[model samples]
Target chain A: MSDDRIGVRKTYKLAIGGAFPRSESGRTYVVRAADGGFLANAARASRKDVRDAVVAARKAQVGWAAATAYNRGQVVYRIAEMLEDRRAQFVEAVEAGEGVDARAAGALVDAAVDRLVWYAGWADKVAQVAGSSNPVAGPYFNFSLPEPTGVVGIAAPQESSLLGLVSVVAPAIVTGNATVVVASELRPLPGVTLAEVLATSDLPGGVVNLLTGSLVEVGPVLAAHRDVDALDLCGVPAELVTELEQLAAGSVKRVLRPPAAALDWRERPTPHRMLAFVETKTVWHPVGV
Target chain B: MNWEYAPAPESRAIVDLQPSYGLFIDGEFVDPGDGSAFKTVNPATEEVLAEVAAAGPADVDRAVEAARRAQHETWGPMSGAERAKYLFRVARILQERSRELAVLESLDNGKPIRESRDIDVPLSAAYFFYYAGWADKLEYAGFGPSPQPIGVAGQIIPWNFPLLMAAWKLAPALAAGNTSVLKPAETTPLTALVLAEIFQEAGLPPGVVNVVTGAGATGAALVAHPGVAKIAFTGSTDVGKGIQRELAGTGKRLTLELGGKGANIVFEDAPLDQAIEGIVNGIYFNQGHVCCAGSRLLVQESIAELVVEKLKARLQTLRLGDPLDKNTDIGAINSPVQLEKITELAAAGVAEGAERWTSPCALPEHGFWFPPTIFTDVSPSHRIAREEIFGPVLSVLTFRTPEEAVMKANNTPYGLSAGIWTEKGSRILWMAQQLRAGVVWANTFNRFDPTSPFGGYRESGFGREGGRHGLEAYLDV
Candidate 1:
């Protein structure tokens, strides 16, 4: 496993457009290991950082979305490959943060990688699986296609830090929607490391912008932000969900209310679709023209 | 809203609805293959309402086969626009004959006239109208390209809201292009039978929507019917479990809206007067026959006595009598059996040391009736507190802290709906998060809209009805 000491922290900044820069907020929050050891301080993304991520996402999304579903599938597959390559680092991070056994961490890492592959496989086929044509009366050719809801803000699950973050973010991005993921409060190292993988993979910058901070601090900000069209509240605290729901209600943004029970990260496949995260615009032109 | 006697409409002896009613199947009313029939009593008068057909295994088979035949060619291949027009016709006829439907619903099902008129009829129309819109918009509802209908749906509706339940179950199934074999509860079969007439009048294809009647045996048969591809039931938790167990090995899709013992919490800071009104409506609505009725009341300890005082005063204003009366607030128990159950549970509450109080309301001698009941000094572990009595009964428990209120509110296994009464927006938000119930009503209770998802948790059941989520129940995900 490559150690953090080997890579070393050069600068703490927001990773936008595949480069690191100080957050527009010029603020940082220190992350710590479960044992109270200090991890690196992560950038506190401001509204500007969110917008920058959105801009980068807007730039990359067209090309990424226009890429053949099969090619998009391959890019997602690359993410899984990189994740599997760094399996040991993830295992170690989960062990240090969650205080779990090496055996469980190993299984979690395998499951997380397997989840990535599962979603990657669906990148090309979700359109076929979830969209449909209706038996319209006239020759107008009415059909429904699942589209990405656009820029989503996710509060990752606290317990299964990396895997939970991946599960939520993968579905949004694989469906062609960009995301800003708020990493787990108690465990943040694995999340940042996973971000590093996304930076190197074919996944364009701003497709996923990872943040590490107190959920209470950034959750409402992201939920209330108008630019984010949806909120994937997979791991929010029960006491805060209603507030987030109220905030999300302001813009009528879609909110996938958090699951009542904690996630069983190992068993379920995270489904991802290019269409689920983006809207389809069907243009009609006369055949003669 | 005090209980007042209204004479039954001059006998209607001239219009003798046949003593024996048959299952309305394959576009015509027919006797069940099994020669069984159960007598339904008018809960208000204890008179034999009618002898309703008790469907058995053979009857279920016949209905399923009929639906299967319809789905194969007649209904299944119809264009969405054509089906939408049929639904629009049905919706129109429903509005045209809503008064008749509402009167029968109140008479046979024992819900108050106001609710039957204001809620049941309108909601039924809204359901058909809502689903009617979806019929043309099916391709846009997110089912895969070339999404096809799952064949026959075997639906079992509860007694409480007979026609509304049927509307809820059938509207989506039909809109999604599936035929159905629906079994309304034994006690309330009239409205569903009338609905069959409406379907026929709308020129709906024969066997498209078959209405059968019976109790648990019939429901079991419908659930086990192999020809049916999906089962949608709205009933008790016990019956829901039986259906779940029966469908375990079979790959048939199932959606059950089961029992609930929801919490109605009132904080000290709430508008006490409005909270009191919400409390009465929560527990006393429809004789508390509602699945999402707020049966448990958790008051802040300091305000418990004050709330109880206000509740008793409000209870006086709740009228109880003939369900057909527009002014009636509470109505007769659906049946003698249900009334007996409520009485037995209330007796148990008293015997178990809780203070049982009933409003000073007069009761008629013949029919099944229960005054709005409230029990104080109740513990969370009490049977009355935990069990779904499905009657006009409320159990009062007190909490000290915000955390304690949340703990008490979510302690029950059922999670269908809950009510919160507080002025602080932050407190409402905090409490809404902590509560596990599916639909949380702030400062209100027993309110429903077609756009909101409604269901429950734990033993209460799974799968939502209404909203975008409701589409998932009918669609193959």
Candidate 2:
């Protein structure tokens, strides 16, 4: 049975430099629903596209990292609000992509937004919680602050598309590092949709760039990127993890090792995740008259 | 004003330099299996202070095994408060014998006695005391509720400040319940061996802390040892890189406090006289052997001539001679290798057409000595401006505005430290944000505290030492 009225389909594209664009390669892949029905085409992100995303992310990192913590917190919080506004869209996308029941998909969307909110709150407080006024044995003022590790490249988790992607992206960017996220292999529609939400929020362009493509193609390109200061290999396919980790060491890039298996995206998040991508800076000034 | 002061040498009476020394392992002085021995000399006098055993792979293996057994059997299982008492005892004993250690350090490392007494020894003891209190409070250290220590730590220290670096590495490692096998610099292992005696006297577990002294091969063996879970190295960038390459696939945790060519930026509105003092302290302190020494000076173009004049005047007042002299402003270079590096870099500055001005002080003929020197009309691309000379040399560059000053200051790859001299508080804060250094000194320079986390950015290496950050490197989190 078909309805007389045809619905307007949304165009799915890669997010780079704050704009949605079709792949520079003019390539697209069929994204079928769980029932094998036709869905929107997802952009096939090329290696060049990932490089461009890294360039864009690097261009925006210093400004984003320089923003006041309170301002960054408010902007991140605004993203949660936008996600809340588009709540129905994510639930549908998750349900269609992952074959999840409506209730389970709804829980995923709620957790994603809540995760954004939680990371939003962390933006203003991570330094205080992690930093300290060192009781150094001298007449000097000493303090250590947790600073962002510049541009980060993340391989989004393959299993929990929305919640897992948000989990990795939010903690890294919440502390002021710009990110280039390679969406999940099996499921990416929810993540791409989340990118649309990030575009509309007050976040600056290139703060987070999303690319949808084959993990094998786009993952190693970012891992070897010279400008990318850190790599979170949480979603790298099993056989590729060791090679990527080894290549990452050429630049001495800070690495977050991939978990043994997919993490439970529904698990509560903590600040320990944020710490992996921060550099502690100690400042000392003489207490002179 | 011209009358020379009488010889004010600090007596080496209190320290009884042993004829020959053995490695301190498992609370016992043990001979190296290789039967090879090396002499540690006084750079100020070229006199062999003592002979030390050279540890080979077998010795490092033995030490690592001891530390592993101790961590599992004794030190690692001890309560934090109980550990705190042991550290407190070490700190007290250090204070009780700081004078003797200071003389030994000056005789061995060739740094002036006043600095050894005032800066190095006191700071070392202070660090032990500071981290002692932290032993019982790891739960609140931001890693986790019960952050567990990462087992045996293999530490390699530099000749510049051997004992201080040892304290920086060991205090926090012990505070977090880790056992250690420390390797002091080849030329300066006396104070570290002395501290090993203090550890035994404090009733610490036999195998908890071991001092294995030798050169590069010994340190390489320690780094390659499989039993060690962590490595803390304070040395040159080249050595740090080799260490980093060695641990690539091993998953060994490492923290490197490496080389730096820090910049001291002075604005036109800065207090002129105080800025001069800061400039002297920045480059001349510790004979400029400091890793975070402000070797580059960025002065405003409008006041560049005045700053150079004042700096030269201050340099003239600097006393250079015996490191044991209580009043010596600068001491002998640590070794002949270090002196050659300084001589080569200073000659490079002259060849590059920078105007050179060295203090009118005669160097001793027998030992390695370098007078306080500065080069003006320096371009950022010059070797003197870019390299870590690790000696008493300053490269002066001028900028017309605050923006230009920041641009010049951050041009280097090393970000270990930076100094900003400005009367305007807002301007200082603004510059602090722009400077890429790990430690930003607003108006003062060459200041260090155990509470301050110290390290670098870019090729200057990774991880921090000291403060809460120091504890994190030793903990599993």
Candidate 3:
């Protein structure tokens, strides 16, 4: 069955508003394997692209958040199912981009799939864990519930492309926030492929917009975006964290700073990530017949 | 026939005024390192009550050092039960001295004596008592199995509810076993200084709680200090943003309870009399110095004119005069600076073409006073409807549908608090879910309890101040 045929290569593009399009700047950057072999050219997203993604995210946020929590859970779990189906493709991308052995890459892909399933379970349950029925000393029946912080801007981790990107994006969207994510600048193939999985998994368009570009250029624009209600700076460069934070302060965006020490992606995730971007809304009504 | 009631004044003799005061550091009243002093005046009469030390950077540093020492030596290593006892004592002492504290608070903060006596002072004591129980119950708080304190907390509170804000910040931090360096707002430092006396009478350990009184520069120094691990501030949105920016990469935990222009929505089906009372309490209480005051009134268009007419008639009954007068419904503005800001913003409302209707109450000549005002036909774009005037000014806007009401209510960057008046239970619940605010009250407004968590969303800032959720701010999760 060995025939002399050339295999078609996939064209890498930015995912914004559930559609794959070339960067508005019409720019592309070369992506190389660990051994410096040219893998492919990825769309180099510009500040304009960031702005478009934010608008898309804002547009989709209300609908996505309005969906029943159970429906959201199923949609997230569907993403896991789709990712599991494309495990081999992600393993190959991770292996090349991260300079890891096939087994290591496979393990990373498995963890990413499991992370999605883990977050899927939280979509419906997070409110119960994070919210409370306050016993106010009055005639009022008071209760507090967690609501999603509107549009979140995420900078995916520079290392551990697939797992780290999945780790950040899942917790954000599972809590019903629409996201504008800047993927791993050096190795964005796995992130874009993950976007493909998301697009087909019944996730709403614009719920998860992925961009591949320089974080230095895109980070500030995303941080400073007035439409963005929150930020996850897990992958922001150390030197730029303060500057980006200052920019984020202008709009009072809820910011999650990077860990002081490098995180091990293999560690079991905590609910803190999901809770960080939620606002606890307490409602009161008089207790009367 | 015209009838008038004689003035019923609350006795100022309840509070014993000191000629001069020093900063409370290391459980002692000490002079500021920089020998600078400022006079604190009673806003109702512009009478200089006492000369208070103005703490500088050196004082802030010393306070932080003392707090850090307390954390390491007395507070952190102590058992939760032992800590609970101290907090319990503090609560008891607060309740015992509440009358004196309330009188001083009214004098310094320019709030009505009724509010200071009934709401602010009692709530301060209630906060201490509530957190006192939580001191020994950390494991059940759900943060973790053995949550640790986040070292010294630098607490900066606004002047609006001076002693109550102090209680909101310190009770939780201390109950969680952290030491504190508190910066009381410059205009209202008297009650907090008296609170220091209560802490001493409770036999609290030296350096456990330090009070530094100064202006913005001292607060800036306290915020920038390296030894502080957490910062809990309640103030304007602009200053909150500045503090957030300053602590950018410092790894310090922060919780801010900032400003808001809350909306109070009234539907046609609402109980008319009760809704009118709620509307008055929502904005006119505390002279509208409250951060979560319902400054924006969103009424059902069918009843908008009726509501405004009733509101105007009700405003005329509000007595605006001396804070010590028990019958007075509205008090003096906190300071000349705050009065000027309110006047400027109210003028902007009139200039922006909103119809302003001010009450005909006679303002006292010697004090800072602004008549209770209402602006009808206020567009969402009007400055009065958008910005936090922090005075007795209410903006009235009408909407035809529930959806429009929700949309107009959430139009601002602030999401601190809101109120809904409707007899229908389902609509109340639906509006509560739709409005993007931290606290939503149905059939009531400006109601607070120690067990109820209070905070805000969006640009109004983050973190709850009361109940179980407040423990997370002081704990290292």
Candidate 4:
């Protein structure tokens, strides 16, 4: 197949902690486009992949969090720059796979990159707008601050693939969260490509892992998993939001529904830090001063 | 599961109007261990209904502890079948005394006796009967292999349909083997208090369904109470947001069923007479004290004039007088405050340039009554169109196409309910899909069933309250 117009082969694996690796299960599933074109035989991530992702997230979370907020912002901005450099490729690929015009494809990719820049700026500043010092009755000087909600399980949107996937992934990670996102079953090429970008970016391994497979087979596994802290169900099927909502409540994990089609995504307000996550800390001081 | 229709004769003696009251905690009624009594008025007659006990933080603590104790040893471990039996007994007793309860509801809630008898009372009994069946068949509810009760629930109901709202809150909680400390709305606490009596007569365990009569302070106390495991509230959007904010940090489980400025859209293809009737029932039902009331009418421009004309002619026949009278249709505005709100919003509509009209219905000199009112030439941004008046006032607006109707209907923040009056089945299906409201009533306005899910979206609040979905509020998955 390496003749004049034949295609070159490449290996597809799970993206974890900014690296590509084979599944621990050594299983694979063939991916096909809507037209029945063979895309690739991608590695099927196992439960072990979920555990490793959690461990990697736990490892990187402290360092990522301890870094100055401005520094994190700078790192996030760098990814946006990388996305901008590869803009034409994304536009071309989105048009080819999603069947949109070049102009719309370009706008889609640009919006995705712009969202990274937008939320990157929010990484440190959201706390200022969302939390405050409360005049709660009694005792010590009390204040509230937003904290990461740990590992989030995201079901990336099925259509408007590029921009939708970026919108969900950036918000979770920008707030110091790690994510294991299940790409769309019918349109996952953009997600897998975006994962390649993250693999080369500053995102720590396992901090953002991308998986491509059947959502019906995989969504319940992520939902019922005790280790998952929160869920961003952007692309979840309508018939299943309630069931997933019920399961996510087991640990009181914060669950956000997908925005409606008519919702003004560009104008929608960013949720306050305290609104999305909570921080509970215990401070011990001498009783007698 | 049996529903009986009985004429509820006018009665001013069932309710003993008093000056003030105290909290009902444990099994005794006491002045809030903190002295604050709220004024409760009969919505039908602008009369001071009673003084209700406003529970303070301390009282909330006591009530929560009592509920916890009750659930811990008394009610929690009871078999599902046993819970069902108690609910069945409660349902039977409610039916046996349906007329008295209906009269009490009409008096306190200000809904016409016809609705109180035919709609509210029967529906309340239906909720109890339906959930009673589910008490032993929870596995069939699709929860999972295992579903458990989320212990003590603090429920807050509204004044619209006092007894029905209480049944909505209590039946599911009790059927799921959960204890509740329920706070009835300050204006309509009698039926809920009577419901407590029914529980007592049915030999229900103490604290299984405690009624604490109070206003915002009491509701806040219950919602903020730490000992309570879950909080379920049915009220206004503003109060719902406050509760959501208060529960922000506590990680307390919550389910909110709040306000809705529902849109009842009528297309030219609709059955004109039936659509007009639906429009009347949509906004004028319970004198528009419903959270899901169709306060905004989006009439297709092709027949806008005809629909308004028909709607106006139908409004003339609606009787507005004593709520206890079986023939009364529109009845009285729930209270003076609600009437004032309706009057203020209606005046604001005229001030904002909407053509205002009212049916020539006479009001009693003693009660707080308002005629069924309509406003035309209303812009999408008019307060009468945008804001919730929560009374018998409808703002009329015109749309050109299906897309425009859907757009105008879903423009508001409240997504509780929408009514699509069209004979085209395909059009209703399409509109139902596009309109984002939780409940979509097609060719019908206020038709409700124990099997259908009902609630709101966005600011109208989260969580369903009826059918299989209602179990979510009481379940620990």
Candidate 5:
């Protein structure tokens, strides 16, 4: 009897501080395809794993955010380049997890790479787009500049794993923020693979840290972490949004709630997302020498 | 001068007063659930204009429910073109009724008729027109290709610039397809109440625009209502902070246009005449009930004494009292409580060791009034300099260098606006950069256009109120 060629199995692990490692808790949870088939064992991240990821993000934030906007743009653009070269791998992972047709899955992979390029372009232009010189009634030069909001915690989308994850994660880092994301709980392989790509993209270490597991276990840890400056509650469980928001308020963390259910991720984005993750800083200098 | 001029009050006959007013909900006049009512008086004459119903918590809930229904059942389902037509209708009706509205606004809010007629009424109409055009073009406004509305906005406007502030909040809300429950300040609800009639005539669907007039308790109820999708407030910083704290976990969108103690800096090289004119328009306009009023003057130390002398002379020429008077430069205080607050703060300037100067003008005996006053010998730490009195009171400070001028201008927590007057083009640009205020008026003050974005920073609150940026506040994006 002839058998189909055996495909090589891949290990799914957490990527933090530029390296792939299992959860510090040494625990793993099985992720499955929509058809109830075994996909892979994703590292079940604990509070300790979150702490290490935040430390890496915090260590990497200053260097990444302070890098010239041009350099950052090139780094993110390189991520799209890497994503393009490995398109088939992402396509297979997206289909296994989403149960989408092979063509639809390929489109999703292509869209994710395109989104990275979109954000990469914004990296060099955000300051100009959001900043302006004010026409004050004075003899002074006043300008308001948009600055990166530090170290955001992302709860990436659960269903449209690759595209949605890329949508939320890229806008943030391209604008000079570092992120520690809890990738889609049900389907995290594509995200972990993207993190591997990020590791080699000349993107600084800890600039994009990915942990895969039960969001319920890791979400509260990231939300309540004092060091985390912002929380993107996009993929947080509906029931936990308000409670996590309450916890977020303790630190006055800038919170971006999930759009009303009707907001489509596949549509071309506007200027809103980048502006949401930045703070306007107005600086005044006397015009007279 | 008092003996020479006869009574020049603009005809109050133009304003058709109603004996009483009910809360405007779902496109109809309805009584408050609690049956509570308060008298709205003309501050200039101390005569009751009408008895307006005061809203209670239940009333707020009812208004929110109406707004939600309108948002879902009507406005939300309506085409953007249909919404644009409604806004356009409102704008046209406002222009037709501008004269009557101006008289009512002047009577109710104690702002001069000239200002109410030219500035407030025209601007109110202008906003409706400006935002009406934006209704159908929201896709180009940059939120998204198909931007969606956040339903049921709760807006609380202050007594100052009552109709214009209402227009600022309400016009964009409706244009963006969000229904709103607006609470006009109790002291000045007549024009806002009149606006409800305009909304009804414009054929805006039920629950799309509800005006509930009340004071702090009513405003608090509206702010704390769970049904509200967003809260837009233009009032005190203390109350703004309370709203911020109350909505902490609920994740309601909030935009505040709060109090400000803005600085008007005058450089020595400035055209002194124009600088003085800007200073006068800055602090004394609308009896100084403006969040962006240039209440603090930072004059170059070399020219400080001259500026003060000219400012004092300018004050003496200001026509105070009778808001209905077309010639009135400053009008009666809006209310007794506001008068006392102003009185106490002006006294505080004296107690705080700042030399005070009042314009030599007689205030009307029966009504609440305060003469235009300025305090000299003021430092940055003085109470008069540090707090927003919200009256036509100015404080003078001197700085030898532009650095000290910018430093002192930005010393306040309020960054609503600042003024820079200098001859050099580069200097104006440079000064505009350093002043942390949201609206910077170079060689101009107290200027607002429906097309220009306006709001404050820090305690002054968040969100721009006009231009394309204002559209973002009402949209779900």
Candidate 6:
């Protein structure tokens, strides 16, 4: 006996303010598999979408950063767990997006999950490693601690679809900064799937708003937004990086320049990424009865 | 029952000023390539203190070359322990000549002798002492192992705290094993030049620290110099932004300490008397030229009227006179241009419908002066409340609760420093956490230490200037 059935496809949309909505411009672009096969259509985010995402991120930042470090760590760890549970879906997306073999795709997905876990562990320990209690030369008590730079704008890496996106987004959110991420233009399905994982993992909405579209269209808007405190240009095209950086300077936004050489996402990450988006605040009080 | 105090002026004989001064390059005083010169005047008396050489682009090039050579040949090759010794020697020399330096600072910069003698000179010396010890222990600074110096540093400082700002820039650069070409503000180059003599007396290596004096063009030349691996600046936000834009894609390291309009919040349950003293010190210190000066006072609504009345009475008692007078509390404005700017901003406050109260203080006969003034009924949108009025002017805004106070304090683009006055411990902690500023003072105001890191968030600028974090600015991390 022969059976015939139709497979239901997922409509990949931009995640803004906890809801998956189509682009405000009402546009969608076809995303192709690595072998040029037809894949799902992804939302083509516009400048309006960029502004909306920044607003959401700004609204979410105060509460997210106000959450206890331990609680934030738990929320981040839960993201890894949810991503782990949806491993096969990400493996399939990575294989299609990166044109890698099944084994390599599986390895990338696993690295993504482990990267989230690694960053989650840093949520509570970063202050200890980066902060200090100064023995000031005075009759006073002084100490410095790290606070999150609010509302970061991240351009996810274009090539390493899953692992690179995870690598950049995890460190930012783990340090308590809400992020408006511009996912890979050509390969965005894995990023959308990861957004779904974040949504279900108890992570607050607007904390991680993912947008899939043309970087050229939205990169400058994100860079020049006065409300955005920092920019991570890890995924911006080389030709456009300088322009985006110049725009970021208009507001004196803290900019993280992209690597000069090709980066290996599977390598062990450093604490530098987490420290990049944090501001050091020193407090002084008189030591007296 | 009017009583007057006698003038107790500090002796000027301690500073032996030269008729004309040249750029200090390669441990020697040399004439500028363009031979252009400018007169340094005492803002308090309008006397031409000295004729100083104005460095052009060519002179900036010479200074950068000298610093680069020094870094590669001497400073870099030396061990951290050896470097620490030189820094210690410089610190000792500064302390030994503290009186002369302080007197010169008061004459050239127009700040009171009391502040120059006690706050500026001592803090300058303390910075060298603090960073001198960190010279050898950088590996333990938690920036990974074997951090390397970032070649030559190009530093430009504002006129507000001339010598102290120089120390804030150079001590860390030198301690981190980097040579520097420093540019002092045009109006206040005397103290920095005097500091060069101290460096020479201490037997510091030639070109390890070079002083090039000029206006903005010379600073632009130094900033754009390709040989400089880092640029550290403390000035207005506008110029800092220009420099930040100019350095795009060049990959040179940059750190900025820029302008701020800090909010000093007062709670209802606070120690009222101490809070009054802190409120006065926060804004009037340094004649309000400080970058982190608490120019905005946020008093809770319940005590706002009482605090304003008390502040007015306290203002009347502040003596505004000659900077050399030991009894002077408020000194002359730094320059005529700054005085005019302050006048214009204060006028705007009046034009914008805020009530202004000027202290009953007589002005000096021949110098720039502005009385200690405060504006009540100041809305958050007022120009005097928002823009940095780097003069003896304070804007008073009232808040009803802690949340409203935090909201108003963090509303500005600049986040440099803030003050909180309350008797409650948990409230202080909570307020400190809510503020977006770099430095927070609880039950006190305008307190600084070499061991504390100082910088700003947002447009106020990035990177730190003191403590262990300051070393990162001069190192290739």
TM-score of chain A of 5: 0.97
> DockQ for model 2?
0.47
True contacts kept of 6: 0.74
Report backbone clashes per prediction.
Answer: 11, 0, 0, 7, 18, 0
What TM-score would each prediction reach against the true structure?
Answer: 0.67, 0.94, 0.99, 0.66, 0.75, 0.98
lDDT of all predictions: 0.77, 0.89, 0.94, 0.76, 0.87, 0.94
In order of TM-score, best first, we have 3, 6, 2, 5, 1, 4
Query: Lowest lDDT 10-mer window, candidate 1 chain B?
Result: B7-16
> Which pairs clash in model 3?
none
How high is the lDDT of residue A247 in model 2? Answer: 65
- Report the C-alpha lDDT of model 1 over B125-151, residue by residue, as the tens digit: 777877877876777765555567788
TM-score computed on alpha carbons, candidate 1:
0.67
Q: How good is the docking of model 3, by CAPRI class?
A: high
Can you tell me which runs of candidate 5 are displaced by over 4 Å? A1-120, A123-255, A258-270, A277-289, B1-6
Summing lDDT over every window of 10 consecutive residues in candidate 4 chain B, give the lowest-scoring window: B1-10
Candidate 4 CAPRI level: incorrect
True contacts kept of each: 0.00, 0.44, 0.73, 0.00, 0.09, 0.74
Give the per-residue lDDT of model 3 (tens digit) for B1-477.
243569898899989999999999999999999879899999999999999999989999999999999999999999999999999899898889988988899999888899999999889989999999999999999897899999999999999999999999999999999999999999999999999999999999999999999999989999999999999999999999999999988888889899999999999999999999999999999999999999999999999999999999888888888887888899999999999999999999999999999998888889799999999989999999999999999999999999999999999999999999999989998899889999999999998888888999999999898989889899997
DockQ score for model 1, please? 0.03
Candidate scoring better on lDDT of 2 and 3: 3
Q: For model 5, how big is the iRMS in angstroms?
A: 5.8
Q: How many backbone clashes does candidate 6 have?
A: 0
Chain A TM-score from candidate 6: 0.98
Summarize candidate 4's per-residue lDDT along B260-280 as a digit string, tens digits.
899998998888987888899
Candidate 2 vs candidate 5, DockQ winner: 2
Instruction: Give the C-alpha miss distance for residue B365 in model 5, angstroms.
Output: 0.7
Cα-based lDDT at residue A184, candidate 5: 93
